[model samples]
Target: MNTLLKIREFDAHGGPSNVKMGGDGHAQTSTTVGRFVIKSIEKHVSYGKYAAWSGIAWGTDIRIDGGVVMVKFNGSWKKLTDVNAQWGKYKNDQKGVADAVLKYQRTLYPDSPIPTKWLFNDFGHVSVKYFKDINKDRKMNGKEYIMGDFIHTTPTDEAATASRKIFQLAESHGCIHVKPNDIDTMIGNGYLKKGNTIEVHPYTKKAIDASHKRDTAKLPFEVHFYPGIYKIAIYKSI
Candidate 1:
């Protein structure tokens, strides 16, 4: 019953440059996902304002039972020590650009599970959803919007310690926070289930110039940290 599931999103208004967060708080914006689908997979509940600021707003607050799945948008909570101090300062001041972003996240996830820190706030063990729902009535300036309208992706409240020095990552008020074993290996290798069809947008200047020519033809060591201090002194003289 191919309900249509060609999901291929790659947003980066502020996040997703392979996650090292610092600017794109609230999981950044811009979402459409063609027409949205994935109706349900429930059990990791905690809707709206993260269940009124962690007040137990529902059942199963997240432990991966059924591993949350209610796509519509309304989930986000960042602060796992500020995403491990921004990838632990890029693995302590860029250890070869954090080992080439962990070798491009293990060559784009080669069987998942490599997260020691940077869990984007742990996400209650993981399996959140949401990458669509354009604007199902969750009005903005029109008044009548209280983190509702759908854009969720639960899990990641790891007991909310609440620190703030300018921290503002929590904003799944349009959910997309994932990690629970990489959504259980994309729903056990099925590429996500429940009437699939996700496609969130943003990043199209010819897909950012073909992702800068596939990260410079295969992460030339994270493209030598993208030319800054003379390309980090020519990547420390090769």
Candidate 2:
């Protein structure tokens, strides 16, 4: 299964319709992937405005948005979920990061020695860092090591609770949280591995302008790579 993540987006062609077809349903023909623009943003009385990603219910407080997690499985693209493959938030929140990950980071991470008191959501079992916002604008500030953000899914048992929000808190410090099974599916099918080029689209400008920057300086700030051999390929320039 040598499936590669190929993202070739296309613009929608919808005007007066070049021609009409005979059928009970409507259809259009295009030779490329479609990139539809959807503006989803709103302001809160206290917290602020954030781009709400699809599938996540309201009041969840998930900061990740404007991107799709997909994989090529069995000759097709499938939506990849966000969630740590193994550990959930409850187990990973307060000092539950794996030893293998720690050792690997200690040897390769620019900021080696882990602080004794570092207690936050571990970067999950298999995390792939993505280009984070460097300019305080919370938008796509280009692919740079601005934040130690990753496309990770902390394996958790609170999918229903966290997803539906029983007063659910913010998912991660700087990582995108997805369904745990999605992580497994990607890894199992070899859709997510080294050199794979997955795309995370940009957030809306209004969403960006209204977004607030977080202070993750006190914690680890190294971008890209965890213990897993898999790596997310980012080739686009900011």
Candidate 3:
């Protein structure tokens, strides 16, 4: 029984290129008026015939499962190959196959190619992992706490304009908490009949100025005059 083996004619760093297999011997049988030519195969042939001439107990009928077969190198399997005939329609495309291979290589063989997937099974350990736990402190001072409800609701553009106008009037007067009805009449131009809550603050002026600066002065510079309505609150600032 001939011992057939698959031998890589290509180097470990390279692929199968212009290389040939070893061993040979030819035969020529004579008949009545003709001759037949034959060749004796060896134990190892080119990578091209790896799956074709497997000499297992099943003779040369030994079959190799189709797909990328991992080839060994220095006690480890790091690379794969497939028979051209069996490669089917998977020869080439733009599906990032080579990129996937390179990614695998970097994962499994971070340091040296000598230690491949078989040796470095835990590829994840070689990579860097980062985690962060953030804790935020939500605390406000007397002024911010008291003025928090001043413009509490999301207002439409027109309502926001009214809110800003009313806030500006109160800020210019330098007082906090005006009569809700008075503010309604003053800023709402008598449109606001129901009295709710109103507050004025110098800090609001600063906030408005900062916001206006941030918007490159596209926003109104003065304090908000007819600020939008807010839920009533009894809070007061020092």
- Across 149-182, the per-residue lDDT of candidate 1 in tens digits comes to 2322232332221111221234333335433343
Candidate 2 per-residue lDDT, tens place, 1-238, comes to: 1222222211111111133432423332211111111111121111111111212222222111223323232344433232322323234332223443244334433253442211122333345433333453434435534223344443231233234433222223333444445445554554444333233333211111111122322111111111111222212111
Residue 18, model 1: lDDT of 31
Ranking by TM-score: 2, 1, 3
Model 3: CA > 4 A from native = 1-89, 93-96, 113-238
- Candidate 2: 10-residue stretch with minimal lDDT: 31-40
For model 3, how does the per-residue alpha-carbon lDDT over 194-233 read when each residue is reduced to its tens digit?
Answer: 2211112221122211121121111111122221231111
Q: Give the Cα error of residue 151 in candidate 1, in Å.
A: 6.4
lDDT of 1: 0.30
**Order of candidates by lDDT, top first?**
1, 2, 3
Identify the leading candidate in terms of TM-score. 2
Clashes per candidate, residues 3 or more apart or on different chains: 19, 12, 14
TM-score of 2: 0.27
Identify the leading candidate in terms of lDDT. Answer: 1
Candidates in order have lDDT scores of: 0.30, 0.29, 0.22
